[model samples]
Target: MHDVVIAGGGPVGLFLAGELALSGCSVLILERDRDLTSPLKALPFGMRGLNAGSAETFHRRGLLEAMLEASGADRKEVGADPDASEAPAPRDVSHFAGMGLDAGGIDASALPFRLPGPAMAGFMTSLEAVSTVLTRWAASLGVEIVRGAPVTAVTQDAGGVTATAGGQEHRGRWLVGCDGGRSAVRELVGFDFVGTDPLFTGYVAKVTFADPRQLPLGFNLTPTGMYLRTSFEGHLGMNDFDGGTFDRSQPLTREHLQAVLRRISGTDVTLTDVELASSFTDRAMQATRYRKGRVLLAGDAAHIHSPLGGQGLNLGIGDAVNLGWKLAATVHGTAPEGLLDTYTDERHPIGAAVLDWSRAQVATMKPGPNAPALRKLVLDLLSTPGGVTHVYRQTSGLFHRYDLGGEQPLIGLSAPDFRFQEGARLGELLRQGRGVLLDFGRDRALQTAAEGWAGRIHYAAGPVRNDLGFTALLIRPDGIVAWADDHADTEAFQRAATRWLGHPRTWAPQVGSGRVE
Candidate 1:
């Protein structure tokens, strides 16, 4: 039986697959779509722009920089140099600062969270770029990516999980459904998807050569939840650029898109060079349950939100990445059953929050009196140092903290970025392919305890700063802290590991001779 089989090959599924494969777990991924070569549409191409947090997550997962560099290198090879092309290279690969347009690189280290940005239209370049790197990375990690294997049915029992796809039957110790928003595996398993699909249909169009002069100052117009282009550059700065750009407050049609350009910018419009365009509704909702026995759901199958936050795709990927390692450990007989349960605990709350934010964004953009008031308030909030910092924090993905009951040091807290004297920094260390286990390397009690779990863990020496809250942290393969000391406790190490993480001996270590052993 395969250790784990993921139902989707989208970025999140691919990311999770990579994590599991790298951790030495045998992973099989079944993607319904036949075209494996086709770049996965990780986001709504016409109207999706990533925040800083998305960029940082890619970085932590060792994908952001690699993907950008790779895309640049590919462009150089293919003569599609982002710097030289009529169409810009995808966003992540393109240096936003160099291009004169960016999310106003404000430092947000001091902030608690990042508020999401107003919806804008940007190229689907970042997702594609990240996918390029992820494809290669996942392959390198030994994940068997099976395309056209539409998962038709999924069922789980006490022993393991069984799935049927493309008329083929497969068995695995666990099955993870990383399918898209409308998940087939979730349906097969009868998981109730709870949430409402909103009425606003996001009409997306990637029209090219739409004479630049014909547009208003803003490259993007948010007048009526409608717009053209990402954002305007050249002098208007960010918000002031596209004024007459299709009042986003109104229902948009293909004609509306064309007319807005011609009327505002005094330019003729035609769709000769149009590359891609489509429409999808903005629905803010999530699955009622993330898991039901050995069959589990991750990615879009678990939560589907409006495209406002650009959170849909990244959220899904993060979900899969978080779940993969835990499932893998369980499969390998190293993690406790409780470890698998934390996936829903940690992720559902984030989904609920996204839903709330998307609703606010939608309400703020509607065509009504509230629009102007909300617009001013939002702009005011976005422009403030505090507001900007909030946006930055959310975008950076650094603010995400797991619930460790205020007891586990690094377990619940995000390990802040730090410069290291050794070969790698904190991110680089965690990026080395698996979750890290930072051993004081000097504490005898800790060392002795670690020695017993030698086969599945890695050791590291940390004179790790004391206030970071974790001394002996057991970081999961997905870079989440599974266990850590609350206040540098030398003896609580084993209990911490067994309780939070899937440490081998989660059950009581049979009171050996009624002594501490």
Candidate 2:
């Protein structure tokens, strides 16, 4: 049996598979679709923006460059100078309802513990680009992917989980559902899904516009609804506040799309041909708990919201990285007690916050006498330096602080990429999928203490360009700072390490002998 059998082979599933495989766990991905390539996942329709947090995640995995290349984004546009001594100002910011925020208005002084790194800015990438890069990476790490195998059922017991997919049963020590919003594994596993219903039905289509000039480029908010026309020819999006009454399962006929667009845009825009189209709703929902016995859920399977603010994909990536290593350690018999449970504990709140964020956007865009006033007020607030900075913190994905019960500000935050005097970086050290113990003081006692968890944690001692007032730091495999110290405290380090990486092993038992010397 494989250590993990994941349902869905999308970006989140593939990324989780790679993380597990990197930690030496056997992983298998069951994908519902026979083909990975789809017109909907390419170019204009699939264009997605990767926030700084997601970019940093990719950088730690050493996949950032490939992702940029796949997305055809200039490296300089998405990253900061490598040799810079200080962090740079924010150059990118997310929008609210249709109102854009100025990156210049973001107060850089408010964001703490930042340093010059390659992934400081967010960039645009397509879903196909992200999927391609992750799929190749997962395959290289020996993850078995079985396409056209949709998960039909799941059963779990004390020993393992058995998932029925494509009429075949696959066994694994654990199971995770990385499937999209309408997830089969979640339903089969009896996870209680709950949330607010959608307020509107949204559409994205690639069509031939007979009267292209009818709708102008950029976001257009009308008294009734909102519609967007991009620079890409015939690429269109519309949000119709028809109480979300549109049947999404039915075919997206050109007539229906034309009617929606005309009504929302208040212009008789003609669609001669529709090359591709898809529909989604702001029907935000989330599983009450991410896990049930041996079965677990991540990404849209666990929680789903509207595509507003473009948080769905990035949120799933966060879930994958956060859960991957903890689940792997649990399967490998090296995880401390309660390690696996932290996945939901830490992620559930974040998921809830994203849902609310989506709901807020919908509220601001809903067709009503109050919507315009609300939108104007929000825009005014978002225009200020403090207001824009708040928005930046909320959406940037870089400022999230997991509740790790720490007094220090840096704890539970993504580690800053500290450059060593030797030109090495904290991000590079994390590429091996192991915890990093950085000792700026080079304390012999701390180094000796870290040896107890040698294979699980890598110890590196050096003088960095900037230490940020810390002499040492313990970063988890996922690149989260588990502990930070102003000085090298060996006992504190050991305790913190044990809390995350488990108790130290001073010796190993002889193979076949089953006994320690």
Candidate 3:
């Protein structure tokens, strides 16, 4: 039996597999699709934006450089000067309902606990690039992936979980559904999926347009609906406000697509041929809970919303990162009490926020008499520096606080990429997937106390180029700031460490123990 059985071998599943393998847990991935290559996963249609949060996660995992190369993005564009004493200003902002925010308006000084690092900005990439990079990483870690195996049944008991895929039974100590929005594991596990329904039927297609000039490029909001045409030739998108009544399973024939485009654009734009097409709805929904006994869900299987803000992929990546380490710890029996449950506690609110964000975009773009007025009001507010900064903080995926109940403001947030004078960085330390305790004060007590958790929590002490006014900090394996203190309080540090990494103690490996010491 594998330590974990994952449904869906896409980015989330691959990433979680790698994380588990990094912790010496065996993982098996059952993918629904036999082939990874699909037109929708290539350029143009497959294009996705990796927010700074996602970038930082990859950096901590030592995969950022490869991801950038796979996406054909220049390192200079995505990274900042690593040697700089201070963090760089934010340089990227996401659009709100086609209304762009000026990166210049983002107040860098306002964001707390930020430090200069390689991944400072979000960049464009495709699903294929992300998958390629993650697949490579997961395979290098010895994760076994079985494609063309769609999960059909899942049964869990006191011991573990057994999943039926492709007419075969695979047993694992735990199971996670990383499958896409239409997830079989979630359904079979009896997770309650609840949320608002969709408002419109959206379409994306690659077509041969006879009269491309008839429809204007970029986002065009008409009295009836909205249509978008990007620089990619023949790439078309439309959002038809038909109460989301269109049956998505129906064939997207050229005639139907042309009619919808013409109606939304209010122009007789001709689609000579539709080479490819897919339909989606703003049907926002989320599983009530992330885990059900031995079975769990992450990525789109846990929650789903419209792709309006380009947050779906990034959100899933966050889920994988947040859950990966905790699950691994649980499987290893080294996790603190309730550690596995915190996955839902810390992430559910974030997922809820993303869903509401998507719904807000759809509301602003919905065809109605009040839409123009609402859009105008929103645009006016977004024009201000404060408004722009708020949007950046919300959308950049960097500023979320997980409510870890620490007094310091930085607690419950991602740790700053603190760099030691020796040129080591927090990001590099996290590549091993273990808790990190940085003793900036180099106090003997703190160092001695951290030794109890030796192998489980890596401890380092030294002067950093910038300590950000902290003498010490405890960072979780996922890079979250579990605790930070301006003074080297050994008692506080121990408490924080014990809360997250379990009580510090040395373990001697016994024969056939199947445990890491």
Tens-place lDDT per residue, model 3, 62-86, is 8888898889998887888866777
**Rank order by lDDT, top first?**
2, 3, 1
Badly placed stretches (over 4 Å) of model 3 are 507-517
lDDT of 1 by residue, 1-517 (tens): 8888889887778888777775677889898988755422433352234443444445456665465464343323222232221222222321211112234434334542122211111223445655657777777766788889999877789988999998998898888888887889888988888776464545455555445555453334344333445452311111112322322556544565455444433457554443444445556668777888888888788877666656676577667667766776776677766788788888888777777766666556555546667667676666655666555445434456778564544456455443233434445555544555675434666766766555455556656432243455666556666666534455566665566445554222111110000
Tens digit of lDDT per residue, candidate 2, span 167-217?
A: 999999999999989999998988999999888989998999998988888
What is the clash count for each candidate, in the order shown? 22, 0, 0
Pick out the ten consecutive residues of candidate 2 with the lowest summed lDDT: 508-517
lDDT of 2: 0.90
lDDT of 1 at 265: 35
Task: Tell how far residue 160 is off in model 3, in angstroms.
Answer: 0.7
On lDDT, the stronger of 1 and 3 is 3
Could you estimate the TM-score for every candidate?
Answer: 0.76, 0.97, 0.97
